[model samples]
Target: MPRIVDRDLEALRETALRMGSLAEAIVAKSLRALATADPLLCKEVQEDDLEIDRLDVAIDAAVLELLATKAPVATDLRFVLATKSVATDLERVGDLARNIAKSAARLAAAPRIELPGKLDQLAGECTRLLRRALDCYADGDPERARRVLDQDDLIDASESRVIRDAIAEIAAHPELSSQEIDLILIAKNLERVADHATNIAEDVILIAEARNLKHREKLERAGDRRT
Candidate 1:
């Protein structure tokens, strides 16, 4: 016979996966909204965000209840803690998606920016990073999480290149001057989404090691300052 604790653990895993899927959906929809400037798609993204917020609240309540009632220790405690962190990251991801959608909605009536191929490539990279990071967090696969982090540099570079081209286009074409700012902002939003994916990967590493690497670079900078 399975213990209630065992059942609860299984439920926790399911809930975490659900949250991840919701986040992934948001990412995909946001990209569609960006690419198409479709008001309907943007509206869908906005509507989906309510569910993500609800899940975040429900997950937080469930995790808190488990902690208070179960007194979980060691690996169990780690799982619950990691789950809470994942929920937060997922919620933020949803918010980013909503922001992108809203921006697309605002630009709906304007002439399309005709983003270069590099923008599509950057978005694809971000989508991959987000999907992999979500999987890693869902399955507690630290290796996959690390790979997601490794891929972020490529996305960042691509974002920079696209933004540079957009800026140049704006300078060369005065007619596009008005929409360029929005396009640049959208590129920045996508870049930030990649950054959030990196944070999720870091959280996975932290959950596995019980050590925080988040400030590792900052610490190095501080050491250099002292030196």
Candidate 2:
């Protein structure tokens, strides 16, 4: 039974990795569509998101089954729980990618609007953070997961700058209000993508160290406020 459980857990990891890969590709394609304003690419991203959603459901069922039947304990239980958490984060990443693609499609019909370089930077940061988070999961490296947390602040700062620039653009040229709004939405989506990546990294930490780092972070924030 132990051997069978180990085999099943390996299979679960493989399935979860496949789901992660698909989610990453969707995010990459969504960014490309945003840069090019291609409606067809946007449609493709939406189609891929459906597959991601299906995988999320399948992974959740597998995790639950393993828990009920295998009765995983210690490290094995951590692996199961982490797989579930990562799947959820990946699914939400897919949703955010779809939202960005939809915004791209909406802007495709309008006059070409120049996207800020910072917007591109933010997108690149988001993709990099996500890839690193997945690497942490693959290697069970909490240090790498900690590094992923650091990258989130960079993306967040970029989002703020882009948002400010977008608002300014809208104020200067009211006729380009739609384009500016799309830029704002794109920045917001990219920020959300980074957030989900951070969640995956946190899950990796939880799996590796058996520490509730998120709760610790909340406590630290509370302490900061009191101080």
Candidate 3:
């Protein structure tokens, strides 16, 4: 027989996972819309965001309820706290996807220009990172979450390359400056999505290991590490 608090915690986990899955799908759809230049798909991404927002509210309520009524401590407390942060990150990821979709729609109206640099590759990597981060959360695998953290730097570099390439393109073809600007914005939104994914991965590590690795690099440099 499970306690009520245990059941509630499991329910909260399920809700978080559901929200994460929806967010991941929204990101993929937004990227597809950008690649195919489909305004209809852009609208769909916007519509999906409402659901993400709702889930975020629900998760917040649940977290508050658990804290006020359940008195969760130790690992349970960490899980609840981390889930709240994860929900916030996922909600922002949804917003970033919507922003990308809007930029895609705008680009669709303008004359087609070759996307500068490895924009497509960057989009793919960001989406993959998001999916993997969610998977680590679901599995409660701190080791795998740490790996996801390591991949953020790669996505950051890719975004920087895209921006540089788009700047060069704008300089070369001043007439297409508007479209180039949109491309830069889309690249930035994708980079933000990757950032949210990394944050979620960090939360997963916190939940599983009871260790705060968000500032792991600085701690390592200063040799102030504690296990």
Candidate 4:
């Protein structure tokens, strides 16, 4: 029975990691759509979101089954719970990626306007954060997970600057307001993706160190040094 439970747990973890990879691909494709303004790629992102949703439901079911059957305790229990949390965050990341793709679709329709360079940089940074967070999970490395937490501040600062620049451009050219709105939304989605990545990294830390970092007052100071 113990051996069977161990195999089930391993399968659950693998499925969740596969789900993470899909979500990461969504982020990458969404960014590519924004850069290329390709309608087909944007449509692909929307389609892929459905698969991510299905994986989310499957992960939840697997975890609940483990809880009911295996009755995991202590560290094992924490691992299962943290896996659920990470899956939730990754689903949200998929949603954000779809939103970014939707905005890119809108941008494609509007008059051609060069997207901000900072927007490109922000997308790259946020993607890196997501990738590293997933790596931390696979390796169960809290130290590497902490490094992902450190990256959140940089993404936040980049997001702020992107928003500021978009606002300024809109003010200068009111006629291009539609494209500007899309640009702002894209930047917002990228920021939200970074946030989801941070959430996943925090969960990784919790699973590895057995320390619940959520709602800790001191850790709030970590966001102070933006970039």
- Against the true structure, whose TM-score is highest? 2
lDDT of 1 by residue, 111-175 (tens): 87675788778878887888888777767788888888788778878888988887898889989
Overlapping backbone residue pairs in candidate 3 total: 0
In candidate 2, what are the lDDT values of residues 1-227, reduced to their tens digit?
33336688888888888888998999999989988888999999999999999999999999888877778888889889989988998999999999999889988988888889989988898898888888888888999899998887788899999999999999999999998999899999989988888888888888877876665667787784321
How high is the CA lDDT of each candidate model? 0.80, 0.88, 0.91, 0.87
Best lDDT among the predictions, by candidate number: 3
Ranking of candidates on lDDT, top first: 3, 2, 4, 1
State how far residue 164 of model 4 sits from its true place (Å). 0.5
* Model 1 stretches astray by more than 4 angstroms: 1-4, 224-227
Error of 4 at 142 (Å): 0.3
Higher lDDT: candidate 1 or 2?
Answer: 2
Model 2 residue 204 distance off true place after TM-score fit, in angstroms: 1.0
Worst 10 residues of 2 by lDDT: 218-227
Candidate 3 wrong stretches, greater than 4 Å: 1-4, 215-227
Off by over 4 Å in 4: 1-4, 217-227
TM-score of 2: 0.94
Cα-based TM-score, every candidate = 0.90, 0.94, 0.93, 0.93
